[model samples]
Target: MLVISGAVQAGLAGIPGQSAELGISLTVMGSALAAAGWLLTVGWRFTRKLPKPASDIPQVEQGIRITPNIIRVVVIGAVLIVLASALFIPQVGFPDAFPILGMLVGFLWSVAAGLACTGRVMKTGRVMKNSADLYARWLSRR
Candidate 1:
């Protein structure tokens, strides 16, 4: 959605007197992208299925181990920075350049966030598969 909106905004950039419209589009798209990023990060973390413990460690001991997800943190942070920078689109001194830059930044950031999410999902899926396989092997050995 954001990518499409950015493309539309880019197309509208050639028209004169569209700075206001462009600015409005930039603001809306930026906010939407930021919100989506936040939701994606939260949803991903909340919905993630943890791999089953491979050892006989107690639940309390397992809960104390914290594995940081650096990719998610970086992606969310970049999206936020893009969102913040986007707020200045309307205030740019040159109206003509606003749309182009805004479109570029918005589109790029949206893509980055999307790819990050995809990678994380794939990684999680792989882990889940491996854990299932391990459990199946253990059952077979029983």
Candidate 2:
């Protein structure tokens, strides 16, 4: 979406007096991407289950210790603020470039959120592996 919007914005720039139209279209696309990113972050966090505690599984405790959701929220919030400012401030940079900046900010925020979620999944996978090993050991003893 970001690439498509950027290409369209660039294409529109070649024409005379299409600045306003391009800005409007880019703003709409940026807003949509930002909203979608926000929703996906929320959904991802909510859907994830915290790793179960296991006395013999240090990896489980390690996995449950980090809270990436807070980091995600702060990063996304900053991106949103910047995006809004870019769209509305009217003096941050070139008048024709604000929309592109907004879209880029939104896309970056989405990427950051995805990275955070991936980190979380990796942590959980480590915890699960630890738990499985512990379980297998207990079963063998019995």
Candidate 3:
């Protein structure tokens, strides 16, 4: 809606002496529309019930497992991609030195995500083993 209103505002900009008022009105309307959209989305989310926890998955071990080394490699590869993108933003590009800021930011975030997944994997493995023990005990009771 904001984009549509912005285009309409631009089309109307040619009118003599109405540009200032038009700009002000469009800004207010655009801001209000954005706020209402945000409110609706958040309100809708609030109405939904939370699902079961991760442990509710039956026999997690039977599901596919991600090797830790692959996660590390993918993170490094993504950071490299970010560096390449930042260096070649122009159409006729003169490749510049690596962007330290962008690379550093990407590396930090990717590492954080990788570490989080690693921890989760370790915990899930422990939980899977423990759940098997419970299954064994349940079988013995029958």
Clashes of each: 0, 0, 0
Tens-digit per-residue lDDT, 9-81, candidate 3: 4444443323444444655776788788889899666765533234644444433244455556666776777
TM-scores of the candidates in the order shown: 0.34, 0.35, 0.32
Model 1 alpha-carbon miss at residue 17, Å = 1.9
List per-prediction Cα lDDT, in the order shown: 0.56, 0.59, 0.52
On lDDT, the leading prediction is 2
52-115: candidate 2 lDDT, tens digit per residue: 4355445544544654665566577757776687677666344556455545555556556665
Task: For candidate 1, write residues 9-116 as lDDT tens digits.
Answer: 656575545644654565677678878899879966677464453443343233223212444454566567556656765655556654565565556566555655
Clashing residue pairs for model 1: none
Candidate 2 matches the true fold with a TM-score of: 0.35
Q: Which ten residues in a row have the lowest lDDT in candidate 3?
A: 94-103
| Candidate 2 wrong stretches, greater than 4 Å | 1-70, 73-77, 80-95, 126-142
Worst 10 residues of 2 by lDDT: 11-20
Better of 1 and 2 by lDDT: 2
Error of 1 at 15 (Å): 11
Q: Which regions in candidate 3 have their CA more than 4 angstroms from the true location? A: 1-65, 91-115, 118-121, 136-142
| Residue 109 lDDT (model 2) | 62
